[model samples]
Target: MSKIASLVPESLKSSKPSLIRVLNNKYGSDPEMVNLTVGEPDFKTADHVKLAAIKSILDDHTHYPHNWGTPGLRNAISQYLARHFDLHYDPEGEIFVTEGASGAISTIINGLCEPGDVVLVPCPAYTLYRINAELCNAQAVELETSAPDFKVTPQLLKEALDKYGDKVKVLVLNYPVNPTGVTYTPDELRALADLLKNYNVAILDDEIYADLLYEGEHLSMAKLLPDQTLYVNGVSKNAAMTGWRVGYICGPRDVLKALAKVHQAAISTNATMNMDAAQEALLHGDEDTAKMKAEYDRRRKFLMAAMDKIGFEYTKPKGAFYLWVKVPDGFDGDSMAYAEHLAEKAKVAVVPAAAFTKLPVRYFRISYAASMEKLQKAVDGLAKVFAQDQAD
Candidate 1:
């Protein structure tokens, strides 16, 4: 037999490049480069939250935590969920705090999927879902939702269930979606709940951006489909605590028990200080989150107006800090090519829409998580590029 060069399977080798790295390579390293490619909040973590973590460290709370998580943090999560979503979870047996939403998702997939199981993922999805599914030896089946609204309709879900049958064991649901920023209404979620109730599928509900809703109250699938949903959330988006790497999952006791074993084997447990900080965030950081959400709402309006003036068609995102803009007329619809042209010719960097999916050229995603001044400058640069395209 030939010498073994690498243990990784061909599936992992074929995974796509990181979108942030691709944009950075195209835009070159300039301190002045205005980046709209990242989805992280521009705000810093609240002062009180940081202080709490520091206090924990100073008090000698640095020892390894319980394999699942501390009772205090899990209890905070349970209370937060019930208050916000009217969902009930027993903190002692139903919550598993992991490193972050990414970690929680990986643990869930690793536990639920056997080799060749299929996971239904909506296209233009966050990259981690597919990557983790493939890593778990499961198939990532992309269900395209290019209709007027970028949502998975009941009929579409039925079609997928028919095609994949029992092989499709998990459905990943991300509201205020990463690339599209589209959120589901309560009615839409209820419909999805009814349909999934009939199937043997479970949901990995990623609600990290739920608190960033600008138009209306956020709805959680766990509220409607608690028995079948493993809910994942964190303070990263709400309190700008991304660097802390703290998030948790809530579900049925049995489901969480299985996930905890996977989490223990993989991570042992999350950082002790970070969990302390996250507990403080969930209990006392609402005011700071509200302030950041207000700022994001303002930036969203400004970005929407800018896209309108630039003559670009886009779906107005009601939540999250992203705008999914369609490429302008007379331009080749290849988002990567257009994004590169804008980066090189217009000196602005935006993530290509295709990075979120394999689709015909039409749409691109622009993040408004930057300050207003940076957004205005990027729009001005894009205007120049569009004008030059018309001239050509």
Candidate 2:
């Protein structure tokens, strides 16, 4: 084997790069490219949040922070949880701040999953979860939920629990889910929570997009089953603070205490200034989030209308800024082929849905996180190429 290949783990060697990122790197630089492959909000961080970070730096809060995050930020996170999701997690020992939600996810996976353990990942999820699990030498079992609008139902939960039995260590749940933009109602969440209560698995509830809802209120799984759930969230999506790299996890004290070891060993404590910014965002940036979300709603409406005019079918997003568009018959349901043709002929980029699952699917994801102008240009590009496909 080559020296470069030998230096890395077998897992890293065999892993596939994220297709969403690959497409972004390919077309993101072009001035004419209307990139729609990433979920990052196309908005600036709020003034209050930015000012708090500057204040923290000036006040010499740059020294090593507490391993579980500063008390104030933890309290802010706790308050935000209670205010938004009706969940109460004690700041003293129930919350651990990390680099980002991605960091929190890796910390939780490493903290709880031993080698050869099983992790249940639903289809059309953020691909990072599967990558993180596989990198940990754990098996990621994909629960294919293509039939029921890309959601995991109680029957689906029971089947996986019965099959994996005791080997299952974690069940990841992402709502307003990435790529698909699907969320559950309270009754739907209750049914899944009830079925999960009988199992011996841990729940990694990723609710980073909870604040970006377009319609109904967001319901957290942690509220229904707090005992075994590690609630994950951050300011990245909500506050347009993606570059700040601040995220947090909340759960029972004992579990959080145990997980702190992984967080400390991996990345130490999160940057103190970033935590300060996140705290301000949580406490005072509701108007900031609301303004950005309102803009996203506008963009979503325009994009969906454009899809209608271009004859592209997709599930209407209720929360999160993504559209799970079907690979039209002109493309023969080949999502990758359609994405490629769109990129070349129309100068628009999208992510094929197959990357989110282990199996193939006839769908792709278009992030509506861009401006209305860009959405319009992307739709026009689609019309041109789609017209060509029909002509062919």
Candidate 2 whole-model C-alpha lDDT, 0 to 1: 0.89
**All candidates: TM-score:** 0.96, 0.97
Candidate 2 lDDT by residue in tens digits, 192-224: 998999888999999999998897777899998
Best by lDDT: 2
How far in Å is the alpha carbon of 95 misplaced in model 1? 0.6
Score residue 178 of candidate 1 by CA lDDT.
80
**Could you tell me which 10 consecutive residues in candidate 1 have the lowest summed lDDT?**
24-33
Question: Model 2, 321: alpha-carbon shift in Å?
Answer: 0.5
Runs in model 1 deviating more than 4 A are 1-4, 25-28
Q: Tell me the whole-model lDDT of each prediction, alpha carbons only.
A: 0.86, 0.89
Candidate 1's error at 255, in angstroms? 0.9
State how far residue 379 of model 1 sits from its true place (Å). 1.1
Backbone clashes in model 2, listed as residue pairs: none
